[model samples]
Target chain A: MNLQARRTGFAVAGIAIICTAYSARLVDLHVVKHEEYARLAAEKHSFRQPIQAKRGMILDRNGEILATNLPVRTIVADASHIQNPDELASLVAARLELEKEAVLEKISTGKKYIVLKRMVPDEVAVALQNELQARKLRGIYLENDSIRTYPNGAMLGHILGYLNHERNGVQGVECTMNKELAGVDGHRFIERDRTGKEIMLYRGAEAPAEHGKNVRLTIDMGLQSILESEVDAAFDKLKPETMNAVMVDPSTGEILAMVSRPAFDPNRPGDFQPSQMKNRAIIDMVEPGSTFKIVVAAGALNEGTVTPQSSIFCENGRFSYGGRTLKDHHGYGHMDVHEILVKSSNIGSAKMALMMGGEKFHEYVRRFGFGERLGIELPGEIRGLVHPPNRWDKLTITRMPMGHSIAVTPLQITMGMSVIANGGRLMAPTVVKTIEEPDGTVFRANPPRVIRDVVPKETASFIGNALVGVTQPGGTATQARVNGFEVAGKTGTAQKVSEKGGYAPGKYVVSFVGYMPAENPRFTLLVMIDDAKVDSSVNYGGIQAAPIFSRVAERAARHLDLIPTAPSVPLQTAPVVSATTPNRRL
Target chain B: MNLSFLTIRSANRIRLRPILITVAVLSVILCTALGFVSIKLSQHAVAEEIRKTERAVTRLRSENEVLLAAVTRLSSRQHLTSLVAQSKIAANYITADRVARLTPPASDEGDSATRTALNTVPSRSATR
Candidate 1:
């Protein structure tokens, strides 16, 4: 059996030798060919993406594009891959109107990918592509990208704001609501060539970008245009240090227009100071002048301390009260309540305040929402100085009544006037109307947040009628009278306080606050000409501010389409001759 | 013992069975390796198919961009206004509003950059 054992050993060795060779081949595939196997495995997990979603738009109330993302093209070139570099450069230079040398310089390199152009229009990109393809040129490429575009230009610039070069919102609503305005970026999952070109891999997988939400502002574009144009004129003609205008729906407090002069184009917001970039309607605070008189008048009428027919006795041209001389525009012998506003009698106004008493007068100013923020949804606001009754100075009680010893912002004064105009309910001013989601979801700010009923509707109406006399034939602001509408207005000439110390010597704050269709007001406009033209003859708020108020009021009243109530009222007084109230040697 | 033919034949047959079994095992090990190689080659071909499709998609995209640009240029307001004057399609000089995408109409928000249909396109916006 030794012969049989030897044969068995030989057969077993032969089988072992064959199995070793086969196992070596398998090891070569798993280890020696590891790179190839890994590559093959990766092929299962590749993807490509196309057509990134467009960023959402900013539309006006009527679907006009206040802001939009226009489709732009980025031209790129694979310099190494190019077949005829000169031909591609020539086409790009010709179509893009670029310097031939510049185009040549870009394609001269051996780099596979080079930026030929950026922010190109889709049309230009397609043209370049077509030109290249027709010639079978290989290197040139085009990528579709988007750039933020503002269609209205500088119409509502600061309020609308703009995106920077990196597509970042930097100011205005665009900055404040940037999270909603900017879209989430997404990428194509395609296999890239060594030079970063998307390879000829199969369409594998994709995660599309989530587009941003569209924002529609409360501003009416037409009204915005009107306010912009008017404000521009005021700055040019009047040439004030600064001018601001805000028009809001008194009933709802929805801001129809909020315009500040010295506006910069949002397309290049970086070129200006932060002050020029602010929406002054919400941010800036100025001495309210005589406009604050509405709050005091409305309160006194509401408290039953004064009636529509309540009269005041003026102490000739100047009356000494509270260790101060209360002056009048002229030496009025005896003026009635309505005539007091017509004459802008400081003495009569102080006397009326005295009748209301210091405590009640202070309560009226606070209740009218003065001496505090108007509660508008914006970044910066100022709480104007009213010296809460407990902090009144020796002369504060009397002087505050004549529109002094107090400071107020344009926004605060506007809200206070709105209370009287909107039948005694003080509405909170609002700039933003609504916010929308990408999935067509909408959230609105539509709350009628009343601060307080500072005055009765009847009293407010009575005060409004008295205001009309100020724009009558022989009134303080006669120039503010509209041809069709009986204007209710007040003229104010207050000495501007210096920034360093006390009141400036020569500079004056000449202004007028008025509402059109006097009997039933629809719009309240406040026009102030700070440090206005003060010549020897014509130096009063009636001359400088009243005319601007009238121009703006006439245009606004006609545009608003409000019919005049008393168009044929009989003329009871002479034509306005003098607004000379500053003759008092202070 | 004399030469016994039955015992010798039994021993040879046992040795022959082991030798045949060894050959059969060797043949299967080599054949299975060859089969694995063939399947791997097929997988490589399927992967190449994806690569080829991606190249085709790239070419198509480039072509789409070319066509879109051609359409924009051919219908551009500047091109059409030049066409109208040079071609003399209309009898008299055209108003700016008659041009394509160049001017806004008499009414509505007729800005220069507003979107325009063929009807809204001004045939002549050139002040020349």
Candidate 2:
């Protein structure tokens, strides 16, 4: 071959080899490692941005907001992107009410993600963002966040619980209805620019958040305020270990007002002890004292063991049974069922319970919603301690009739009186009224529920009339009478049950459970004072708790706009004293 | 006889038609590419505008919520109660007798001074 032709052939072969090598490399990249490289590129540019759902608000029956969300921001910094750390830190510290040195220490770490401060107010965060933008600063961002706030502070704290750091409810209605209050969060696939700003053009698939539903409670803030003020005054004056008050609509079993002393502010739950967070109305168990007498009295009448006119002879204040002597506050002769209840005769109640068998009396007790949880919507409700007939000893029948052997919650005592006020039906107590969507559309409503009838209507009316005599001039609880209204109630002065054994000396749990306008009952109220540090003589339920009941009932009546059905009585003037200082009176 | 003359004429002629067609096709391709780029840039600008609008709306909504929460806090029953106790406002509960009810009591036989309504029955003059 010629020399020129040989050189041309060699150049053509070199070009062919280069083309073949390029084809093989293209195949490897397009087929073999395509998925791997694509995934790496996506990870570098795209991320899943979470969209937070707002927590629901708690509202009173009249549409007053109780618990609500205060919109906040979580200030974050990208330390790696921060150019002027000192200026950025100073601005953030001033806007967030934080220390500049601490913020500087955080930004100096050179980390990509740093939380400068959480729960910064929305206004403050906006101001900081504007400042940063005007100065052309980068790296600082505001994350959407919120905090649960109870505007009423410690008022109704026990019923409207608080949330934890993870934004989960820790107690009260918040805990019980958490599923309804916490809506499902959503997310979207998003791409960001080199500056971490979302590239809205490259946004991918997204699902919008489903916000939580609002919860409306049955509580009336008017009635609640009245109850709380009265209870607060009593707690201050009496200086009891604990005090509880609950008001309910007798016909519907709707809880109108409930207050427990030693309450913690839900907004600052961390600052209080666990004891103060207890909802004592449903959680704390105490002897129902003479309030339990209505059970045996009603049972005797219903079971035909004793007529309303049936007379039982009292042993003149003291009676011996099962090797124990039971004494009344005063000596009494023969008294009928009405007189026995009006005078709060322990011996008379025991006699009536004896007339009815133990099993029958126990049945009546359970029928009155005792020994069982009333199924309130609040969390941590207890059934309270009540032994069956088989568990009772010789003295159990006698003592249980007068509320000595068994324990019951203050709520149970109020509901037991409701049986009379509601004409024998024991209605299930409820706090939540309705669950509503964000747009004020009701999603679910809780209607009043009737559990069962404890007695006939005639028997309930008879018992109710007898209870009215309890607040009359000659009765034991005259102080419980409301002006221009007939108050039917019972006074219970129970000796506190000691941890060691029997009753504690000179320490009492005094309570008055009643309903006003006895003929057509409006509400059933209970005022309970535990371990009131007063003289034993002045610590009786009729003397101490009944007066509180009277004040609360009067105010509640006025709030309800109920006109006077009877003549007003003369107001009594009594000395107010702090029970802690027994010798000082106001 | 004239075949050689025809062949020489064809070979010497300039190919103006093919050159003109190729130039036209190249120009069309370049203009289409430029148009696609312009459309993409416009879409980016619109998306950026949309993103700014969304951010503004979110900020405004957040501000509204903050103000609402403040209003709720200030108007809460607890706050009002404290204000009343401090005597910041002169508020009082009207006595029952002073509250003139639209409907008279079912029975108005009690103390006339403490009656809920000023008149037990509707006046004929007012009704007329």
Candidate 3:
């Protein structure tokens, strides 16, 4: 055979082989890739799934909700689906109370999705949906959404804080417990026609959302509301620039209610001043005034420098120190350590403070949890300022005894007083109690905590006795007493120091710190009214602040089922016995 | 030779190879389709149960809201004040309008008895 003929035969054979391979490859591509194509198509119809967890609820000891989420309706829009933006916006605005301009602005840009309005009423939402259909307003929509409702409105506004856009908590416990409060979001992969109506119930990939965990708080809703109402009334009557109050279990350090006035409703925070959003009970600091005398008296007893039997000569109602004149409420000539507090005698307190000196006074103050944060779960906590002994002058030492020349937040002062009422122990005040899973399942719980022991037990009794004396017939805070329960506390009326460190006259911070059932103290309450013009310039804690303390304490005692104190007797006044002169009775 | 060839041709024409190949292909395709459908149906049942559970959660939340509202109403501060006023409980300390001038002579005798009676009577702070 010729070489050319053989080469022609081999070329034909090679061409035939190549053609068969190409045909087989085409068949494989058409048939074998079917599953992949189907998967891609299914993916196009699927919606993104969000994790949704059952949010925890805040409950009272009795299981009342302080904060909880509710099912609500919202307005959603698909910009692409809207054929006429103007028509859709007009109908939605009238139904949802949103401005047409706003609604149109959201979808006019032809974005795929937009929210027109949130938290619409169920009835109004239904009507809006009906209107959308009736008017043929394409893409104007309503959808089911969840909203958080604080049943006790504005009761624990600062503690509960609130959620904003994207369901993120902004402040307070809501923000602090965002992890527990925020449920996982969910997605639905339903098959919808071009008109967006459901064709098949579901035809795409889906993963159900797991709901968020629920959080239960330690707050009692009834107690919270009671405190809130009382504070509100006091705010109206006293008209303080700002006011705050705290009630705590002295023994347990469990914070019952800590309310700061001029508060905003978390459900609608827009109506209030943003500055008022801070929880002044734990954040704002001012010279605590004479109510702080309880700390000094407790310190004196702890140091064994004085006792109820100890006596001192009050400087005839007037004594001078550090180029400043100190005055006593009464001309308590020769009085016992208890008398000094009962009468709020500044002269005696100063003389005793001189004996205490800067080092001892500063030490006691630090021990009382001053100059330290409470480490509460809430945010924006400020550690009140307590200048070190090195920073104190002779005047500061004297003034510090009576709640001046130093700064402390209202909450810290209450906690300090609680040490005396609770037999020398201080607790870490808590607002949250527990975290729970869906269907009332407890996941994490917070137990009552003892922060530390601030003083000796015997010293606490000595201070408690003197505090009780203040509510006696002629004491400085008789009005703070509960009828059935013995009330032990002190009154504070301090002149606000101006920016220049001078007394800003006529501006006063009036407050009262007291404990009920003085014999067996359960709760210690502190009421602080800032810039209080008591009784139309009523700065006296006995007259203005003490009354609120009385109402709150009495009611709280009864509500908590505490043992009431023995009634006060109109006993004959006892004559003065001891006449010790210039003793450190304060 | 012609008769034998005709007989052989008739037998070859009735050969079953092509029919068997067609049946085998059809059966494999149908079985694959059935398996795919069975898997989808089982997943659908699971998805439906999840939907039911989600609806149950929504229903429970609404029920809780109603109960919370009831509690709020009963414990309202205003309600307590009205109850207190209606009950007319007497105070433990009956302070006179004037503190400094009050004499010990004005205190009620047998104060302990009055307190016992007040405790028994739930109408007011003090038993009338």
**Per-candidate TM-score, chain A:** 0.79, 0.92, 0.83
Provide per-model DockQ scores.
0.04, 0.66, 0.12
Please list, in the order the candidates appear, how each scores on TM-score for chain B only. Answer: 0.47, 0.61, 0.41
Question: Model 1, stretches more than 4 Å misplaced?
Answer: A1-55, A77-114, A186-188, A193-205, A270-278, A307-310, A332-337, A354-360, A377-379, A436-449, A534-539, A568-586, B1-128
Ranking by lDDT: 2, 3, 1
The true-versus-predicted C-alpha distance at residue B86 of model 3, in Å, is 16
Residue lDDT tens for model 2, A1-586? 5888989998998998898889888888888889888778777878878899988999999999999998999989988778898998888888788899999999999998899888888888888999999998889988899999999999999999999998899999999989999999988889978777888878988999889999999999999999999988888788888999999999999999999988889999989889999999999999989999999999999999999778899999999999999888899999999999999999999999988989999999999999999999999999999999999999999999999989999888988899999999999999999999999999999999999999999999999998999999899888888888989999999999999998899999999999988989999999999988788878888988899999988999899987778789975654444685542211
Q: By TM-score, rank the candidates, best first.
A: 2, 3, 1
TM-score of every candidate: 0.69, 0.89, 0.75
Kindly report the docking quality category of candidate 3.
Answer: incorrect
RMSD of 3: 10.4
Off by over 4 Å in 2: A1-41, A97-99, A574-577, A580-586, B1-32, B104-128
User: Which lDDT tens digits does candidate 1 get at residues A1-586?
Assistant: 8999999998999988888888898899888998898667766555345556556666665555677655678888877777676777788899888888898988887886688778887667777778877877777767778766565556688778777777777767777667767767666556655444455433345666777777767677666666667667656655555667776667777677777766777756767776677766666655666666666667666777777777667888788866777777688767766777677777777777888888889888888887788766555667877787778776776678778888877777777777767788888877667667655577443455777776778887877777887788777777777766788777777788889978888777767777666666676666665554445245467877677676676567656655555655443332323322332210
Which whole-number lDDT from 0 to 100 does residue B55 have in model 3?
Answer: 51
Please give the CA lDDT of all the candidate structures: 0.69, 0.90, 0.75
Name the docking class for model 2.
medium
